[model samples]
Target chain A: MTARRTWATARRVLAQLRNDPRTIALILVLPTALMTLLAWILPDSEWQKYAPPLLGIFPMLVMFLVTSVATLRERTSGTLERLLSMPMGKGDFVFGYAIAFGVLAIVQALVVAGVCFALLDLTVRGSAPLVVLIAVVDGLVGTALGLFVSAFAQTEFQAVQFMPVALLPQFLLCGLILPTEELPTVLGWISWLLPLTYAVNAMQHVVVDTQLDTRFWVDAGVITGMAVALLALGAVTLRRQTR
Target chain B: MTTAAISVRDLTIVRGPVTAVDHLSLEVPSGQVIGLLGPSGSGKSSLMRAIVGVQVMESGSIDVLGQPAGSPTLRAQVGYVTQDPSVYSDLSVLANLRYFARILGVTDDSVERVLDQVDLREVADRLVGRLSGGQRSRVSLGTALLGSPQLLVLDEPTVGLDPALRRDLWTLFHQLATAGTTVFVSSHVMEEASRCDRLLLLRDGRLLAEGTQSQLLERTGCQDIERAFLAIVEGGAS
Candidate 1:
């Protein structure tokens, strides 16, 4: 809970991200560039109509990739262990890492939002602050998932083994590619339990809402609650690993 | 004698159904170099891990630096360099030093001074992963010595070093001992075994002997520490 230690951890992580070119590219360039490319290629009829849902998927994809890659790299290189040995507590480390990744997620979210406006000629139906809030919630959830995966992973190869567990289930059940109404009853219930499902729905409410929706706030609350739960789980898992 | 730097009472560590380190009550005094001597799988490394809070003890109390081990203050005061070189391989020697320096909150340029002390300032720009085994060991030593810790715990530090460097490293250890740093080095090296101020001989998760080199030899009527170790292990059978 110490802000000073959290800031130190965040600075160290920022320095590493700056030094790593591939990570920098992934953080600053990929999301917006992909958004622009998709905006340009898709015509006005079919693809442009699905821009909101597709755009919602972009942040989760970015979050999953960045956090998974970053945590795995840190664990494999022993930096995670080194951090654990420092004066910082487990909660602070998780919060600091999540804060930094949240910054990156904000950047990526903005780029996607910017591309939607500039390239696709689409206006956001909701306020920009709501969009930023969604990014923050997504970032926290993603950081927790990444740290949880890193706890069980001994190496980068083993960390990659969590891709199916971390990413694939959300894509399949989170109503990304298909509608939740079309999914099976049990599978649809599982999708509702996913953090990303709540995040995506919240983003959709932000970017495509015709009027104020109470369900969007509920979705945002669900996402935030999931983030808190995942963070607690991550902290316990990390404590076990360090011991 | 002053209070023991390390005081463990009935220390036992069980990894699942297997007891890695059994009921091992012992005291390691301040300003003395104690060697935890044992072969692989003999609970030597497990003892080191339990000392620093990395491994959990099933039932026991470990008092380090006059407080319970794994306390925030005790952990910050003690320096533990694991058996494996835990330095960042991608980071240069200077970068590695700076990272630890920042972590320890040492304000001055202590990294260069530590590297100089270890005679590694010349290769400060080289990546740690690219360095030879002995050089990496020096870096690990530098890290443990960074804060001038009262209790320096090193696990198998000289495993890959050559004879001459190993001798020099032991000399450095003795120098630290004279400077009042309580050095605890775990190793299976018999020759280096003689350099410790005291020895904690362990086998199969139990303490076989704990005393000075001369005391152990006289008690067992053995020629050297190695012979004394064999006699103790063999004598335990009867």
Candidate 2:
């Protein structure tokens, strides 16, 4: 709950990440590479049309995997127990993670969008900053989701298993494969409930509009609320000590 | 005049059908290095966890620093190092200490001071993962020393250490005690009992005896603490 302690936790997480070069590469470089590969694999005609929404999805997916596993490491390593025994609260621990990964998400979004827009020629009618903004927001959502699911997992392998449970549904139903309206009625309703559905919708809104539009605002609000709710859940489930 | 650093009364902890600490009543005096001695699974860990306010108990109470165990006020006052070297192995020793000191709101100079105490100053920038097992443990110990905690709770810190390193750590514990820090150390190694200011001998979640080395030796009429422990266990059973 204390801001100073939360800031300290964020710095500690960043320091830990800095020490591992492989993880750094994974965090800063992998998403852009995968997005480029996506541009290559898909037909040229389809790639740009899909790229904007995919920008949102890419960071969320990558950040989710990385954040969940990293937090799980903190749990297993006994550092979490030590900190909780100190003057640290669950809010400081979880939100501190949010701030650290929030920084990572910004850097990641910029790199991935930078490469796609500059080289792959992904077209956007709206402002480029809006595209980057949505991508960053999606990354935050992914980080929140990662932190929440890590509570259920004891080992790194178990954390990986949680990805499918927490993320795959959002992918399948979030309009990546098909627009939410074209799906079966039950699935369409379900997709409306998924945070990534709003992420995809908001990105699609950006693809056609010139400035911040009303529909984009609505989707942004919903998904942003989703991020806050998920982060709170993460804090609630985070244990001070392993019983 | 002796004041209680820690006081536990009728404490019971049930961990899924096993009574880890059953009706345990004991008091640790201020500024004394009290050893909680027991065989493996004798509830030493459970008792330590209770005293630090991390473990859930079935009934009873523990008071630490005149506050209920686990109170927010005591979080900074009580320093606990688990059996595992819980420090981040991925970070440098200095980074580990700095991060903990920040959480405790202690000055960063304390981080350097702790590095000196744990003898990790030479390898301050070295990643904890690269250190020897004994060195990694020192990092955990260094973390607990931050903020000049009033009470230090260490759980089985010497379980896997070499004899020389173990002796050195014992020296550090006594030094901290002399500075008016109540150090509670747990050990299953009977020989280490002689190093503590007083001892609480536990077996199967209950206290067998509590006294100084000489008192325990004389009371049980044995030559050494090891034999004295066995005799007490046998006599208590009968």
Candidate 3:
């Protein structure tokens, strides 16, 4: 396909995103509401005392879950196939979705940040830009995984079914409700592979200590790697799905 | 006459352990209306998709509009309409047309012309899912017609249309052929298949025959294309 046609496909996906009010609301509202709830409920004293990980990782869960509704719907409704049949590249579609979901993630993070600053009286250890950057990376990882899920899923129900398969394991290993340090060696190794573990570690540093550490960079790297891997798998799966 | 618009040599599609389209070799010339007539599971839809590069073949070669089918450059030159009316249900008729036109690299003027030709101008603002079945077919046809593609591949375009509308759609296909677009339509209706300039008869994942309607009728010593088809299949069975 020509460059012009690729642009047109991106424009079409954007238009559909705009017209689908339910998706628009989910994209814009759900993350912020979840963020507010998590921020007010979890504090440094409570976090350090009981479930420290959940306080930091809750936003990552919300970001990843958001893609399930929008991306999965597009694949199920035949919109993705329709786009593929046209003069659009699979890479373009993936990138377009990444950008859309990334924006929504940022907006959600900001709302949570706002709530964190005001109600929870929290401050980040790292630079504000670094904190947002980590959040965006987590969002991209979520969206990429969602894209892979949509590619293999034959129906909306199948797509939704992936959420539990995707979320429950991450929640367990992410050190969100359970501390990774306290987990067994085998489980700790598994947690290291998950993108959420790194993301929460990075965000937690910023949200709690207001400092940038090696852990932040390490988290970003892991999440970025997961995004790339998921994207490659998503492309191959999408190609096979259409074929 | 123009060169063959689509040339397939040893085209084969395999699903699991079964050969869906087995070594199907055929040449379709430009401006000719060709029918891929077969029963269910005879690979009609699979063949159409293979020709358009939407289906991957296990072993085969396809040249569409003098270019290999899977090449992105060549893929853009042929229009493919699938079995379903896959327009967004929430979008207006005009919105869907414009969206497809843009994706196919056609301008708004071309979109308007195609919609007008399909008689969708009056309901351009209506939602596509609300449109009648026949009207949806026109929209699908209009999408394929945009950019004036050199070849058109439509799989079962008239499946649910009333007899009258089906006939009208055939007329539109003929008109398109006159304008130099090679039209390959898949249909199970024998009468509809007879209207094609040439016919390819397929059964059990193999090519049963390929020739003009009259040639098939004469060769099989049958009264009509439908009888010719039945005779050949029954004879093969026995």
Candidate 4:
């Protein structure tokens, strides 16, 4: 993809988002609010225990909703088709969106992670900056998946509906409710295949391990690989015209 | 067909159970406004889509600017404005133009040129969502007009504009053609048909008649485009 086109798409998306305050709030505020509510629900120590992994998943869920809905709007509104006809590559459009949402996702990551550490009394054995970094990467993964999933949805309602279908399995099997090994053999296998599992697996090690360990490296590698692969898939699958 | 701005040879497009464009063959000459007129479902849009290299044809071939339809080279050379307002309403008119200008790899000056051309200079900074329906269409027109493409395909561009705006756009079409840009426009308005250098009349995804306005009237023994179209369609039916 050409830098000019990708940067143009990103700038245009940001300008559109700037005009839309409600979507901004949804992307930047919703995660912090949910995490805060969860902070209030459990004891501080117990909350810190769950917060790292939940931080990984929270941005994923929120960015997925925002990115998918926004991308689906481009599809249903006819802009995507119009832009495709111009002197542009599908990667330019998709990656431009990824860069735009990825920027906002970084903002969301910082805000949410800051809330977790300062307000929620989250203290861990490892690097909090590393936790924030993983959270940002989680946002990128969400952005890629959202861009990918939007192709399957025809309307905003359908796009929103995909969140559950696409993410519910990730939540259920990502060692959030149960450790992966404690699950059934088939489900445990499925969890290993999911990026959320690896993401959660990596982030949780932050609270338990004092240093960057080999297991954490493996999980981090898997999640990062998933992000890159999904971004490529999204670019390839984006239709330049109605099929 | 080889030298024309666009050439379609035995092209057929099937959408669901119906053939949107049925074995249609036509040569759109260079540097002129060729108006395509048809009934609502007569494949006016489907044909425009094909010219823009976005539609999937069931058979035959379409060559644009001496290249196969949908070729990478044509992306910058051909500009397409569909029936819908294919622009971001949340952004201002200026923002929309600027973004398209960058995407088309044109200089920043085109945004100002299009703003003036579309007569939205005063509202350039206003969000497109807040503009009138007529003005929104002009924004889409401005998007296509960026990069100064060799072939411009606009579908029903004047559907919502006033007579004054219509006249101005027709003037602009001729001006672009004079500068060696081939403009392919589609419209249902019969009055606008007379403004075209050539016209292609379609019915049921088939070419009913085509020629200059005077030629069509003389051939059908009718005084106006509407009657000429009716006469051609009715005579061919029997």
**Model no. 3, DockQ:** 0.39
Q: Weakest 10 consecutive residues, lDDT, candidate 4 chain B? A: B1-10
lDDT of 3 by residue, B153-230 (tens): 888889988888878888988999998889999988788867899988888778888888998988899988888988
RMSD of each candidate relative to the true structure: 3.6, 2.0, 3.5, 1.9
Q: List clash counts for every candidate, in order.
A: 0, 0, 8, 0
**TM-scores across all candidates?**
0.85, 0.95, 0.86, 0.96
Winner of 2 and 3 under lDDT: 2
lDDT of 2 by residue, B1-238 (tens): 3899999999999877799988988899999999999999999988888887778788999999899998989999999999999999989998889888989999999997998898999999999999999999999999999889999999999888888999899999999999999999999999998899999999999988988999999998899888999999888742
Candidate 4 per-residue C-alpha lDDT over B147-236 given as tens digits, one digit per residue, 9 for 90 to 100: 899999999999978888888989999999999999999998877888999999987888888889999999989999999999988897
A best-first ranking of the candidates according to their DockQ comes to 4, 2, 3, 1
TM-score of chain B of each: 0.96, 0.98, 0.94, 0.97
Q: 1 or 4, which is superior by DockQ? A: 4
Residues A20-56 of candidate 1 have per-residue lDDT tens digits of 6787687657766776777778886555455655565
DockQ each candidate and list the results: 0.32, 0.68, 0.39, 0.73
- In candidate 3, which residue ranges exceed 4 Å CA deviation? A1-7, A32-79, A112-133, A152-162, A221-225, A240-243
The first chain of model 3 has a TM-score of 0.82
Question: Relative to the unseen true structure, what is the C-alpha lDDT of residue B170 in candidate 1, on a scale of 0 to 100?
Answer: 86
Instruction: List candidate 1 stretches off by more than 4 Å.
Output: A26-44, A72-82, A110-137, A149-163, A181-189, A210-225, A240-243, B125-127, B218-224
Error of 3 at A92 (Å): 1.2
lDDT digits (tens) for residues A1-243 of candidate 4: 799899989999999999999999998788899999999999977898899999999999888888888887887787887887887888898889889998998898899999889988999999999898889889989988998878655456777788889999999999989999899999999899888999998998999889887898888888888888888888887766553
Residue A60 of model 4 has an lDDT of 92
